[model samples]
Target chain A: MIPAKFDYIKASSLGEALTLLQEHGDEAKILSGGHSLIPSMKLRLATPSVLIDIGGISEMNTITEEGDEIVIGANCTHHQIATSDLVREHVNILSQAALCIGDIQVRNRGTLGGSLAHADPASDYPATVLACEATIVAEGKDGKRTIGANDFFQALFLTALQDDEIITAIRFPKVSQGTYQKFFQSASRFAVVGVAAIKKGDGVQIGVTGVSGVPFRATAVENAYDGTSSAAKHAMDGVDDIISDHFADEEYRSHLARVYVKRALEAL
Target chain B: MNISITINGKLVTHDIEPRISLSHFLREHLDLTGTHIGCDTSGCGACTVTLDGQAVKSCTVLAVQADGSEVTTIEGMAQGDQMHPIQEAFREHHGLQCGFCTPGMVMTAADILKNNPNPTEEEIRHGLEGNFCRCTGYHNIVKSIQHAAEQMKA
Candidate 1:
């Protein structure tokens, strides 16, 4: 099916992209790798007046190492991240999660930032990033501001980013070890229950996906781990309050969450 | 926009709408109908093509995005009048029945072989996860890929 007609602007630099966003306001949508946005446009779920293609912005496509964090440019494709030597050495969980996203074709075109910005509850990256306690950098008329992963994802298909802002990069703190475990729905490859666990010096963080409107942390499981109880069972215990629906009932998703959390913790 | 791309070893330029999908560009614009579009949603993998030496779903990519890239379609896989080893193996092993998914299946298999010259049966199955066949002929497809791998190695 053909998408609705809209003006296309290929921005060569970040400044040009941001200016276009400011001018178009909510009527503009930024296109990165076009893995997420293009499909939505084709389906008519999104009909923006202007499409600002930012894939050519070279500055937004690099993966760099800062003091104690790894900064991944928003436009970095999943294929690039999954095969990066730096990611493999420093943050393997992201690479592991990237490998499981859709299939090879989707991985070649999907970008890390687009996935996070799209804020799909079933996506694998949000939970992994939340578990790693990453920060998102958003650039707009107000300049730059960083939002924690937990604060970044506000609701289903929603983010803390303003309509006129563009996500520039994401920063992940260096962790000793981390792993992501996902149970994908067969056809769409969306997570039925995805878990990401990170081992920081003396603490562990657990993030659960495909079980709620937005990816959330399993605080009870973390608390249980701190108290020397079984982390997975405790995480499952906290599932009573989580929202549920047709894709996966509360009971089944809870059970899968426990199973995945245990597996992720074990792998970590 | 007038976009120029090297497709299947041929340099072609087309002025088309930005919304035109690469799959449509190859099939409708260039008349290289070997690349089929099974599902416009990018699920079927029937529109797979090598964009800049990397396999991507053509349905998901815009023609403008591939302007500066080299694309290898199923039409480009064969040499002169001879079939590629994968194609020959498929024919020998009866990898296709209806032939609807043949081009994409061959292209995806070629990509896997390019990366892994010797893939186990399970590896071949996992590599073809993106491509689907309604005839349930995956068993023979695996054999054909294995046979082609051996032929290429020889």
Candidate 2:
């Protein structure tokens, strides 16, 4: 299926991308890997007048290590993340989550920055990123600022990013014993309920996806971690306003969330 | 918009609408009908192609986005009368029944072998999940990839 007609502009660098975004305002949509945006465009769910193509911007296509954090450019594809040694060393949970996203084809072309920016409720990155306590960097007319993973996702298919803002990179802090476990939906392979558990010293952080309007850190589960299955099932006891869809009712989703959280914590 | 791409080791340029997907550009414009479009939403990997040596769903990629990139489709796998080792293995193992998903299967299998030359049956099965086959029950498909992996090693 062909998407509706739109002017495509390739940004030569980060500077050009920022300028184009500022000029076009809300009429322009930043195109990274185009996995999410192109599909929505074809379905007529999104019809932006202009597409600021940032896929070829070499500046925003890297994964590097600086001190204790791993900095990944926004254009870093899931395939890149999955195979990257730096990612494996710093935050293996992100790579594990990246591997579980869709299939090999999707992983090759889907970008981490794009996924986080799109903020799909079922995406794999948010859970791991949030669990790692990552920070997302954005560039706009006002220069640069970092948004914590906790405040990044606002709702389903929504983020805290402004219309003119573009995600530059995501920073994941190195942690000990991190893992992700997901119960996948049959056809799409999207997470039915995915949980990421990260262990840093005596403290454990947990994030849950596909059960809420947005990906959220399961604070109740994290705080209630007593290292037992009995305590794990009650992780969702206070997680109200769970999303209900055709694939799963709210009750089932909540149930899956707790089960997956227990499994993730066990793996960690 | 005018964009140029390297398809099957050939450089081609076109002045077309920005909306045309890489899958559509390959099939309609370049007449490389071997790349099939099953589910245009990137679910079915029928339109799978190697963009810069990585397998990607072409339907979810704009042709304009492929500018200055190299794309290897099913047409590039074989050399004239000589079929690629993957194709030979598929034929020998009875990997395909309908043959509708063969191109994508071969393409994805090629990528898997590229990444991991010798993959287990579980790995091959996991690799083929993106490219769906309604026929053969996937037993032969797994065999085909395993066979191809051995052949490539030889």
- Models, CA RMSD each: 1.8, 1.1
Taking the tens digit of each residue's C-alpha lDDT, what string does model 1 give over A1-268? 7788888888999999999999998888999888878888899999987889898888999998998888999999998899888888898999999989988788878999989989888899988898999999999998999999889988878999998899999998877788999998888888888899998767789888888887898888887785343668877664544557667788888878888888877777
Q: Clashes in model 2: which pairs?
A: none
Error of 2 at B134 (Å): 1.8
lDDT of 1 by residue, B1-154 (tens): 8999999898998899988899999999999899999988888888999998878889888898888789999999999899999999999999998988888899899888988999999989988888888898899999999999999999
Worst ten in a row by lDDT for model 1 chain B: B126-135
Candidate 1 lDDT for residue A168 = 94
Which lDDT values do the candidates have, in the order given?
Answer: 0.88, 0.89
